[model samples]
Target chain A: DTAVSQTPKYLVTQMGNDKSIKCEQNLGHDTMYWYKQDSKKFLKIMFSYNNKELIINETVPNRFSPKSPDKAHLNLHINSLELGDSAVYFCASSHSTANTGELFFGEGSRLTVL
Target chain B: AQSVTQPDIHITVSEGASLELRCNYSYGATPYLFWYVQSPGQGLQLLLKYFSGDTLVQGIKGFEAEFKRSQSSFNLRKPSVHWSDAAEYFCAVGPFGSGSARQLTFGSGTQLTVLP
Candidate 1:
């Protein structure tokens, strides 16, 4: 079974359109995260939720919202997507809420906005 | 702010030769360090991590890293590399805390090319 999975492996949408990416983890982890990898291959953390509680919210714009309905799932919804939103979004999870844990990442969803 | 720095953007090596990927970091305290590898069209995989204990940490696929507090660096190394080992390597640093540390600051990845 896949430990961490994300839907919509590839997304191509027009500007101003709204989109959502769903993520699920079966590792029974408490912390789930959303990361964005730009064209330069720089992975930056956008948000993190621990046990369904919002914990880390980076400098991401308000247009990006992360919802953690439960400990096993964390989804990302982008409103008013623009050309700058084109990048690879990855969903990751760790076994514990502690920072010492290693993250298991999903295959990542490539989003291309025109 | 915590940050990870990977000096080389790309490196080419010969198969059966050794490999070392450099990674430096800037953090307040002893930070949680990690090395991850990503193949083409795949998610990142953890090669190794360092929390506290031994400075030299061993990881899967014959990979290892040594954390140096004096240098503020965690460098990944392998004795012999196969063609399959060619991938993008990333160095990341987490804060020193229970909850906040999960927010990782990753360096620009280094791409490895193995020549015949």
Candidate 2:
């Protein structure tokens, strides 16, 4: 069974279009995160939520919004997507108190804006 | 701000040769370090992590990382490289805290290529 899963493995849309990517984790972790990997393979954190509470919100554009309806799901919604947004988006989860600092990632969602 | 640096952007080695990937970080206090491997079309997999205690940490797939506090480095090593081990490796650093949220900062990955 997949511990973490993300929907729409590939997404292609025109500029200014809006899209949403859903993520879920069955590991029962309290914290979930969203990361963006650019073409240069530099991964950066975008947002983090703990038990449906927003914790870290990087300097990302306001167009990118993260919503956690419940503990098991955290979805990313992108509005007014630009060509610069063409990259891989990854969803990850981890236990809150575990000092291991190990993150379980989901299959990335590749978004290409034309 | 915490940051990670991977010196080698791409590395290629013979199938039976030894391999080492260098990772360095800058943090104010003791940092939580991790090594993750990413195969094509798949998510990142946790290979190993170092919180404290022994500097040397063993991970799956015959991978090990040594944390050298003096050098501010955590380097991953493999005794013998296999063709199947060709993948992108990422080094991450996170703050040591008990909060329910711990966000990781990842380095620009190093791509490994094993030549048979």
Per-candidate interface DockQ score: 0.61, 0.64
Ten residues in sequence with the least summed lDDT for candidate 1 chain B: B95-104
Query: Any residue pairs clashing in model 2, and if so which?
Result: none
Model 2 misses residue A15 by how many Å? 0.8
TM-score of each model, paired residue for residue: 0.93, 0.96
What DockQ class does candidate 1 belong to? medium
The lDDT leader among the candidates is 2
Q: What's the C-alpha lDDT at position A86 in model 2?
A: 99
- In the order shown, the candidates' Cα RMSDs to the true structure are 1.6, 1.2
Clashes of 1: 0
> How would you encode candidate 1's per-residue C-alpha lDDT over A5-107 as one tens digit per residue?
9999999999999999999999888889999999999898899898999988999999999999999999999999999999999999985546565788999
For each candidate, what is the lDDT? 0.91, 0.92
In the range B27-79, model 1's lDDT, one tens digit per residue, is 87768888999998899999988889889999999999999998888999999
RMSD of 1: 1.6
